[model samples]
Target: MTQHTDVVVVGGGQSGLAAGYHLRRQGLDFVILDAEAAQGGSWQHMWDSLHLFSPAEHSSLPGRLMPAQAGETYPDAGHVVDYLTDYEKRYDLPVQHGTRVDAVRRNGERLLVEADSGTWRARAVISATGTWTRPFFPAVPGRGLFTGRHLHTVNYRSPADFADQHVIVVGGGNSGAQIAADLALDGNVNVTWVAQRPPRFLPNDIDGRALFDVATSRRRALDAGHTDTGGVASLGDIVAVPPVRAARDAGHLHAKPMFAQLSADGVRWDDGSQSDAEAIVWCTGFRPALAHLSPLNLRRARGHILTDGTRALGEPRLHLLGYGDWTGPASATLIGVGRPARDAAHEIAGSL
Candidate 1:
C-alpha cells in the first residue's frame, strides 16, 4: 500500500524545513522527503571557504536563530550545515531521507509523489528542492573540445589544485571573484576572470542586513499591490567582503568579457586574441531542480513554473517554495524563506 500524508514537503532543505515547522504547528500530517542520505542540504556541496553574505544574526529561519562564534561576522559553509542539522533535530520535523522523488502527478484532487523509496499520496505538495544540484554552463563554441581541466562551482574546492597555472575563472558573481582571489593569493597563479559584465560589489556597509531590508520593503510594496522592479538583482552580485576587498587590492578583481570561443588549450577572444588556460573554473550559476516536476506540465520557459505567490499557477493544491524570489520574496535566503513557508503551510492547511 502506498503511504499517505496530509502534505508532502519536497527537497528537505532550508525551505522544506521551514515549511515543515509551520505544517507541524498546523497539525498537518507531513513528511519532508530529502534526496540526500544525510541532512545539511546543499550547503554540504558548496566550495570550501564560502561564507554567507550576511552575519549570523541576520541569517536565520523562523524559530531558531543561527548561531555563530561571538565575534564571527559571517558564517562559513560548515557552520551553516551544523546549524541546519541542529535545526532539523530541534524541530523534530518528520523528514524521510534518501528518498528521491522522481515525479509528482495529479491523483484526482490530490497529488501523487513517486520517489525511489515509495509513493506518497498527499492532499498538497510543497516543492522546496532548490537549485544546488543543477549547475549551469554557457554554450560556447568548441567547449566540448577544450582539453584543459574544468569544473563548475558545484564541484570546486580550494584553489590549491591550480597553483602556478594559467586558469580562467568564469562568471562575475561572488563565486567567480572569490575563486579568482583564492587562486591568486600567492601571486604565482595566472588567474583571469571572465563574465559577460563586470562584477558589481556593493558597499562594505551594505551587507546582508541592508539586503534583507530592501527585500522586506519590496515584499511589503507587493503586498500593498505594487509592482516591485526587483532591485534585488544587485544583491546577488559580489559584495565587498574581506576576501573580495583583498582581491581588489591585489588587482585580481578585474574581469574580461566572455571569450568568443573555447580552444583546445584556452579561449579565443572575439578580437582574434587568445589566452592560454590550463584549466577553467565556471561559476555561471544554477537552475531550479525541477526535473521531478516535469511530468506535471507546469514548467514554463526560463527554467521555472509560473506562480502566484507560493502556489503554482492553476494548481492550488501544489506550492513551490524556496526556488527563488519569484516563488517568494527573498525566498532563497535563510532570513527570507520563513514568511513564504509559514504562509504556504497555512494556506495548505486551511484548504484541507
Candidate 2:
C-alpha cells in the first residue's frame, strides 16, 4: 500500500516526537513511523539502574515540563519512558508503531519511504533514528574465542543477575562508571572498571543543566563565526550522581587500564598479567542508525551523514536529527534535541 504525507518521521523517539510537535504547530500533515512495537525509544532498553543526571526540568522536551515524582530529583529510565509515552498521547502525534522502515529512496520529487507496513511518499523525510541500536565493540584479541558471557550496555538489565560473578566493565564513559557502581552494591559481585584512560568526573554541584548551558553557549559562538572558548563537559564525564558518589566514597570506584586480550575464562592485561572474570560488560558506545538511508548515498566514510544544520548536505529533502554532536551541538540529550528538531521542522515546512 502507498500513502502520502507532507513529512514522514522515521523515528518515534524523543527527537522524532519533538519534530512531530513542531510539524503540527506548522499545520503540516505528517506521520511518525516507529520501529518498536510501542512507545519509548532507547530509554526502554536502558539498564534498570540508569537515571538522568539532570533534574526533571532540565531534561524536558519543548512542549511540556517533565514532572518528577515526589522526593525524586532525578528520573530513572522507566520514568523517562512513561513521560515520552505521555508526550506522544498528549499531542496525539500520528505515530505508526511497529512500522519498521526498510529503505528511503527518491521517488521523483518526493521521497519514497518503504516500511514493513506500507510505502509512504513524502515531500520531505525527517530521520530521528538514534544510536542506541548500534552498540560498538572494540576489537580485542581472542574476543571470539572467549566462551564466558559478554554483553553491552544495551543488553544489561540489572546488577542482581551479575551477582556472585567477577565482571569486567569496559569503557571510560558514564555507562561504565554507573554500571560498575551499581554492581558494587551487590556484595557478591566483583567489578573492575577498565578504560583507555581515566574518566573525568564532574563537580557534584554541576549536572546536565550546566553541561547543556555550556554546550549551547559554545554552539552559539560557533554559529556566529567566532571561536568557542566555553568549557563544557562531555556527556561521558562522570556526573556525581548519588550512586556514583556513594561508590566513590566507599572506595568501590576505581579505574583500571584496558586489557590486551580476551582469554576463554577472562582477560589478559597489557602488562602480561591475567585477571580472571566470569563476564565482560562493554559500555563502549554506539553508532548512528542510518542503515535505511543507504539508498540515498549520503552516508560518510566515518559512518555519519554530513548535513548543513539539519538538512542533508547533498540531499536537502533528507533531514537528520538527534544523531549526535555532529548534527548539532548537544543534539543527543533530551533537552538539547529540541532546537535541532524545531529547526528541521521549520526548514521542511518552508521548503514544502
Candidate 3:
C-alpha cells in the first residue's frame, strides 16, 4: 500500500524533528522516517565523556529549553539524547523510528520514498541526514599493515576501553587531544598524540571571554573570509584552554608531528620518529554520505551537497541543513538544526 502525506522527512535527528514541528505548526500533514530505533542520532555514538562546547542556553531546540544541572559547563551526550526525546514527546511529532528510506524518487508531482516497511508518497521531502553520516579515513600507505587494534574517534567511548594498552591518537583535533589526555591519566595505558602542525595554545580566558566563544568568533571570521592573517587561532588553541590546559600541564597531554607511515609494529612520523602502540585511534573528521543519492547529481567536486540554503539545483522542495554555513547557530551543533528545519518547512509550504 502507498501511504500519502504532504511532507515526508527523512532522518529523525534534530533537523528532522524541527522540520516535523514546523510542519505541524503550519497545519500540514507529514511523516518522519528515521533509521535509528530512537532519536539523538550522533549523540548516541559520541564518547561517554563528550559534552557540548555550546552552553545549555544555546543548545535548546526551537520550543523547549534543554534541562541542565547546576554548574554544568555543557550537557553530556546522554543529556543531549534525553533533551531530544523530550522535544519529540512535547511536540507530539509523528516519527516512525527504525524505518530507513532506501531511495527517494520524484513521482510526477510528488516524491516516492521507498523504505523497508512500505512506500510513502509526499508533496515534498527533507533530507536532514547531517554530514556526520560517514567517517573520513585517509588512505595512508601501510594502513592495513598495522598489527594494532585501530578505530576512529567516532567509536571511542572511554579510556576504560583502552586500558592496559599502548594507545596512539592521530590528528590534532579536539577529540584527539582530549582522548589522548584521558588515556594518559588512566594509569593503565601509554598515550601518544601525533599531529601535522605544532598546536598554538590559547588561554582559557581572553579579555574576559570564554575560549569556546573566542574560537566560535574566529570560525565565523574565517567562514566570512574576514579572518586576520596573524590573529587567527588554530584548532589547538581552541582546545588548549582551561580544562584542556590543566590536562596538558599534568603530563596527560603531549603532541608530535603527523604520521608518515604505518608498520606491522607501529607508526613512523614525518620526523623519522617511531612509536609502538597497541591501539591506534584516528580522530580524523567526517564526510557526507551521498553515494546513495547518485541519481540526484547535486554534489560538488569537494563531495559537499552543492545547494543554497533554500533550494538544491533550483529545486525548492529539496532543502539541505548542516552543510557548511547554512544551519545558523546550529550549523555544526544539534541546536543549529532548528532554523534550517523551519526554513525548509516554510519553503515547502509556500511551494504547495
Candidate 4:
C-alpha cells in the first residue's frame, strides 16, 4: 500500500532535516527521503581533512549548536556529520534513507512520488536538494586526451592524497586556491592554479563579519537584478579571501592562464602555456539536480529554480529550500538552510 502524507521532503540533508522538524512542530504528517544511506549528504563524501571555512558559530543549525573543540578555528566534515546525526536523533525526525525518488508527478490535487521502493502520495513536496548535486565540468576540446587522473574539487580532500604528484588545480575559487596551497605545502607536489580572471581578495574578517558576507551580498544582488549594469561586475562576485591572496603572494599559489584544452601529457592554457601534471583538480562549481522532477514544469533559469520566497511558481504545493538567495544571513551554510526549511514548513502548514 502506498503511504500518504501531508508533505514529502526530497533529500534528507541539513535542509530536509530542518524542514521535517518544522513540519512536525506544525503537527503535519511529513517524511524525509534521502538518496544516501545516511543523514549527511555531501558531507559524507567530502575528504577527511576538510573543515568548513565558516566557523562553528556560523555553522550551527536552528535549535542546535554545532559541537566544536576548544581553540578549533572551524569544524571539519566529520564534525558536521556528527552534528547532523545528533540533530536527527534529537528531533526524532522521520527520515527514510537509501530511498531514492526517481520521479514526481502531480495527480489532480495531490502529488505522486515514485521511487524504487514504492510510491508516496502527498499534498505538498519540498525540494531541499542543494545545488551541489551536479558538478559543472566545462567541455574543452581535447579534454579526453589527458592521460593523467583528473577529478573535480568535490572529490578532493587532502594534499597527502596527491603526495609527490604534480597537480594542476583549475579555477581561482576558494576551493581551488586552498587545495593548491595545501598541496604546495607538501613540498613534493608541483601545484599550479589556473585562473581565468585574477581573484579579488578579502580579509578573513570583514567589518566584524565573516568574509562570506561579500559573496552572500553579491548573490543577493544578482538575484535582485541589481548587479547587471554596464556589463561590468562588482568586487563581491570576483573577490577571494585574504588568506587566498596571501597564498598567491607567497608563491604557494601560482596563477596560470585560463584552461584551453587538455593534451595527452597535460593541460594547455589560452596563452599557449602548458603544464605537464600527474593530476588535475577542477574546482569550477556545481548546479542543482532537478532531473527527477520533469513533470512539475517548474520555473528555472540557467537550471536554477526560480521562486518567490518559499512559494514555487505554478506549483504552490511545491517548495524549494536552499535554491538561491534569501535562505537567510548564512543561507548556503548548514546554519542558513534551517531558516528556509522552517519558513517553508510554516508556509506549508498554513496552506493545509
- Among the numbered candidates, top lDDT falls to 2
Cα lDDT tens digits, model 2, 1-352, are 8999999999999999999999999999999999988898889988888999898998999999999866789999889999999999999999999889999999999999999999999999999999988899988899997888999999998888887899999987888899999998767799999989988888888788988888888888888999767546544478889998899889888898888999988999878888889899999999999999999998887689989999999899999999977777789999999999899999988998
User: In candidate 2, how many clashes are counted?
Assistant: 0
On lDDT, the stronger of 2 and 4 is: 2
lDDT of each: 0.88, 0.90, 0.73, 0.75
- TM-score per prediction, in order, is 0.96, 0.97, 0.88, 0.89
The most accurate candidate by TM-score is 2
Cα lDDT tens digits, model 1, 1-352, are: 5999899999998999999999998999999999998888999888787889888978998999998745568999888899999999999989989999999999897899999998999999999999999999888899998999989988788877777889999998878988888787757788898999877887777777788778778878878999875765746587777888888887877898889999998999999998988999989999999999887889888789889889998678899999888888789889989999999988998899
Candidate 1: where are CA atoms >4 Å away? 186-188, 223-230, 234-236
Q: Model 4, 142-170: lDDT tens per residue?
A: 88899989899778877877887888888
Summing lDDT over every window of 10 consecutive residues in candidate 2, give the lowest-scoring window: 227-236
**Can you rank all candidates by TM-score, best first?**
2, 1, 4, 3
Model 3 stretches with alpha carbons more than 4 Å out: 201-237, 240-243, 326-330
Regions of candidate 2 where Cα sits further than 4 Å from its true position: 230-236
How far out, in Å, is residue 215 in model 2?
0.9
